[model samples]
Target: WNKLPLAVQTTESLAGSNLWDVPTSHLHPSTNFSSKLFWEPQCQTQLRHLQDRTRITATIPPRLDGHWVSSRCEVRAGPEFLTRSYIFYPTRLFKAFQHYYCDSNCHVPAYSLIIQGKLRLRQASWITHGATEAEHNLQKVTLVIHNQWAAHRLETRLPSSCLRLGSGVQLVPSKLYELFNAKAKRDCLGALHFSMMELDLLRLEIQYHPLHQPSKELFLGDVHTDQNQRAHYRPTGYQQPLQNTMHHIHPCPVCALMYQSSEQSPPILPPSWSIPLNLNGHWISQRCEARPAVLFLTRLFVFNEEHHTWEGTYHHYSDPMCNHRTFTLVASGHYARMEPSSKVQGATELVFKVIRAKVTMFEQTMLQMLNSSEEGSCGQAGGWEPGAEQDITWTAGCGMLGILLPHKEYELFKMEKDHKNRSLLLIGERPTDGSSPDRPVKRPTSFQTPMVQCSPDTAVPQHYSSRSDVSTGPEVSSAIIHHSVFSIFLIVN
Candidate 1:
């Protein structure tokens, strides 16, 4: 008896320590000590013996109640010291619900249990003792559980480590376990498996398991505290009461009809044109003869190709300065394409009708009139009333011309090479003789002609010829007979 370990003395010393206190009522009759301390080791031994006979009941912690994912895993064959690395891919855990058991008083926390997540083994390798060769390779082993428990284990097989018992199982120090718990917030849970490498060492394997379902289930037990400071448990299955199984809710007919209508309806597409006109720009005409002096007609043409309509404003300057010595005209009308004339092959012409035309004074001109006391002097000069219709002829090829009011024409000889520039030269002109409207007087051939290079202060020299013999005949009129004789040049800044 003396050689035997003093279990009774050890328990008495334990009770005397402040770490744990034993109640007098729980003392053993023979030893006069707490029965809990005396029988604890024996009970544990019996539990281990029972665990060997039957599979241990795995308990889950509330913290490990989510999904996990894994990319790599370590595989060790039996008896072999070598560990091989392989891809674990991913796994899923769904419908994880945890519950904690409580005493009758429900005061002390007891075992925690969880039923969630499916365990699937992708590959497993087993090697023979003293051999590096693998004995067998198992693949696609799925452990299906309608409701399973989670076992908490503290791995301490590593050198200089502490073991922790959680949820009725021993937990070991493992890097894989730490990683699994670290990502709990992201709902990703990891699984770490251990195989015996030696008598005292363990080989750790890690794999990632993601959550399969988004829905979560939570179970809570009602608790009450008594005067003795002990907790009592009231079991409850689910937070919400289940509905009647006989009746099933059906979807609304109106909602189904609306969804069907929305699904079957086609989306609206925008209207488009094949040959959209690029006429929304500014066009300036060459300096030519006008009412009072040689002037340049600068027009800003704004066209809506979608609407097939155009509006523009034109400024006629007697001098290139355009300071107070300019006339302004506003007009709007619809335009259409005309058939190409045989006389000028490949030339595209547009028929423009001035549905509304109003001549207004330029700001500089108005200001000059106010300053010079010549207000009424420019009142009736070259100004037209609103809503007045005018017919003009537009010929476009090597050059563009807008023949306005019979003999008066605005010619734009220099067009910007870039279609985006939207600029053209305006040359104002008038017929020298009575010929067909299409066969009006031609421009001078010489580029240095005074009419072609008219300056602001310099008067055009009359000696410079303004006409060229480019066939002044009635045949040109017949070629363009199908088109309306209207033209306007627009210049956009």
Candidate 2:
């Protein structure tokens, strides 16, 4: 009880914090690459056995000769909220547009960058496993300020010469400057020497539909999660995917507007993490997701909108194929939904308080480790056993496992639908540092892996509340979301 520094504190309970330098987060989803069908990790051994039965065919690199637009607002390592629109030419030359926003979701307009470069598709990905590695050469970058407010916000980045053109005052939106000309006017666009969007290590993948219809996806190198190492860290993973406009089968109405958008006449692209009108339902991971920690996991969340209470279960695995069993963390909490964010339009802000949590062990290693712990240290010490679920609330959660009980998190949630109009939960990106966001200032601005909604028909226990005794078993049938087969939870509304 003495150690809970962030306990009982609401997001509104504190104030006076510095603004984020850049909300670029390393919260990214790992892929189960096969014909570009992306899914997260699934229930362990179950998914592993599916992978063992899977037969992979040689992959062909997708042609980079069309328009590609971000399906939704994308958040990178800095946890920066932005959108990308690109046009690739047959000659290998390309023009890319990056729209940066001010808030958590891409509601508030900041500025945009029109970048011209060249891309060359190369060998298969050595780092991304099944992805095709590629290279891109920087050519030029143009800055476009949305309005006076945008210019003022970006004033520090512009050189004095950019502000005064032959006179002492000039309109920033009207005049354009070379962000990285390498010849002149270097000071006009220094967004912390932002990795030029970190296009260095490139990978191109494709999403395959039922009829073998392939939608191209381009994955750029992930920027360093640490702000200090961002400018120099070589990308090993990928950022949020950009979809080829001509090929993408979209459920998003904004997809068309995205194709029509440009820096000069940019469309008001809505938040990809849109919040659903109704929240009384079950949301489960449609696919097992890969974590930067090399852990495969899935999450099941049930929310009672009227009561503002929620329950969540996390299934973690040890292998890439998710065949190895790990421990499960079950948590319950209450959420306070706030009004729309002034900083990010259409984005809902909320605070989630974790009232209790339980831990379930599935393997002997976990049992042995917990059994060897000192008395009253980690979950009742010697009482831990295989396949046993224990309440970690008394000890304020397992310190070794990073689970803090009676905890509160300043979380951001947004929702979107797929081609079939299935709901997806796009929650705030977890911090790269693995710490809970206890303050409103520390709340995430961007999203991580999306959770698919379970149809209302999916049976939810009537007794479910913010209580204990949650069943730790498969909630859905087996399905092929990846090249690897993983158990998925999905039902019709």
Leading candidate by TM-score: 2
Candidate 1, 172-280: lDDT as tens digits: 2111122112124321111222211110100111111133212221112111111121112221110111111111112112122222211112111111111222443
Candidate 2 global lDDT: 0.56
Off by over 4 Å in 2: 1-66, 75-81, 87-94, 101-110, 117-137, 161-167, 183-189, 196-205, 221-229, 232-238, 268-277, 318-326, 360-372, 380-391, 415-421, 457-493
Output the worst ten-in-a-row residue range by lDDT, candidate 2: 19-28
TM-score (C-alpha, index-matched) for candidate 1: 0.22
Q: Could you tell me every candidate's TM-score relative to the true structure?
A: 0.22, 0.67
Candidate 1 accuracy as lDDT: 0.22
lDDT of 2 by residue, 71-164 (tens): 7666654556778888889898989888887665566667888888787765443333333456676777887887788787676556656434
Worst 10 residues of 1 by lDDT: 125-134
CA lDDT scores, all candidates in order: 0.22, 0.56
